[model samples]
Target: MKEYVLLLFLALCSAKPFSRPSYMTLKNMMLEDMEDSDDDDDDDDDDNTLFPTRTPANPFFPFDMLPTCPFGCQCYSRVVHCSDLGLTSVPSNIPLDTRMVDLQNNKIKEIKENDFKGLTSLYGLILNNNKLTKIHPKAFLTTKKLRRLYLSHNQLSEIPLNLPKSLAELRIHDNKVKKIHKNTFKGMDALHVLEMSANPLDNNGIETGAFEGMTVFHIRIAEAKLTSIPKELPSTLLELHLDYNKISNVEQEDFKRYKDLQRLGLGNNRITDIENGSLSSLPRIREIHLENNKLKKIPSGLQELKYLQIIFLHSNSITKVGVNDFCPAVPKMKKSLYSAISLFNNPVKYWEVQPATFRCILSRMSVQLGNFRK
Candidate 1:
């Protein structure tokens, strides 16, 4: 009699069956498609391979339960986010159409190729401040439509290059990057913003054509081990960072090709002089940083920068400022302060001494876009 009653209870409780296919099947399918793409392209010419690769192309975002981005902290019911409860890997329960995925504080160190197998609509993926060390090259290959990628505060040494051609923004601050590949940003025409702060650079590590073809707004490389700037920088670059480097000189040839550059930073380096004509090509540059260096004089060609605004030249070993580098611009009434002079942090020779000192540009709030230094 008890056995009969137990069977009835089991049937009643397990009656409602839903279809939740195991993720393994989808993982295998995606892998097989990847293998086929490789086999099809091994020797086949690009013209002969007319079939579109089987990778996820058009991602459809379904926000039913996958809308709220996940943090390493908690979980949220698609509508109300609570917290992530000890997730070791990317959450499997996330609806397929999740757009932005923030895995900031997770202990996830490894990302499998199929981790992002089917989700196509993903745009922003922030994995900052994680304990990750190794990441596969193709870890983001499937995310062709991705836009902004933030991987700061992790253990990434290798700069993520060969990114999808559609990338726009990349941030990777505070990492142990010894070298950077030349082909790192090759073919990234649409890229605009890049940050690479607090990296220990190597001389041979940055490939000659590393930033061959990218037009961007800012390229922050402060607190790096760079000895000199690459000569082939795109003229379209607006802002630059050369702080905390080993650079000793800035010759006229250094700025000969930078025509449209606006801002420049050369603080905390070994620079002693700014060669004349070095500022000739930099027409649009308004603000410049010459702080924390060994400079005793300023460049003369800087007069050509008619749009010069604020010039940082503090924290140097200079005893006296040069009498004749350039005259200051008339301070405009507008908030667009284009004044040229260093304030605080340097010993002025006489009472009338200008170009005397500079200050720090530790714009911490500015989004960093460089190596992910942990």
Candidate 2:
């Protein structure tokens, strides 16, 4: 009888059929389970970010990050300016439509062919003031529209080949170039200005007609190692600066091709003599600088420069000059083209010193009429 009563009491306290838990209690339990799952997912995301399964490191920047230009550079209007940034190579992220690129004052040592491959709109490229030593032969062949290229003040050893024909101005001064090949400027028909001063150019390294068929106006090969004037210079040249070379004399036909030359600078050389009629071809010559040379006497042919304006014979060993040699027709030339002559620091003695105000034209009338030093 006792066992039956205990069983009835247990059945009354136990859960009956079709009975369900409270709705609030079930909702709370689901919320707790979701919170635990979210925590586990957060830890997984952190691990993947640290060691991404897709890549070793993230290649793309965060979407919220801002685009940054090169250090110490300015980018605007599709032009990238990274001058004086101490760059060792050309920046690879330049804008596509960049019209100008100024990479001057950097430490770039070499330029590969693909450096500027896709810069089709680039019109000007300034690479001056860098440590550039070698440029791939086809480095600039792709810059078809490039007009001006400044490669001065560098350590280049040779003139780069395959230059674009559209280049109008190329400045490569103050370099270590030792020679100029025959085809250096072969197809450069539109090249009008070339600055190649301060190079150690070899005497026989220049091939014949290296600068043929160009409209180059000014040529600066000063301080080069030329023992004599290079032949076949362009007739369109207006000014020629060949100062500080090893030339010992000026031949008559040296300048026979330059009829339009206006100024000639041959200073600081070993020029001991200038042959007669050496300067007769340059009738339009205005200024001639022959200072600091081994000249013992003024070249009598210089008197034939009808349009001569000034002649610098300072710091030379000249001993004497004849007034008749330079001014046989002084009365007639005084009205037109008498030039200023500087003879300072020389032992030169003029037998007939005219008035300081007299302007005279040197004449080639007679070589025997004057007692000029031989």
Best TM-score goes to which candidate?
A: 2
lDDT of 1 by residue, 200-307 (tens): 775567778877877877888877777877567676788888788899888778877677788898878998877767776777778888877887655566544567
Best by lDDT: 2
Model 1 deviation from native, Cα RMSD in Å? 14.9
Q: Can you give the lDDT of residue 296 in candidate 1?
A: 65
lDDT of 2 by residue, 53-171 (tens): 44312233333233445567898755789998889999877765678999999999999988888878889999999999999988886789889999999999988889888888999
Clashing pairs in 2: 303-362
Q: Flag regions of model 2 displaced more than 4 Å.
A: 1-71, 77-79, 328-339, 350-352, 361-374
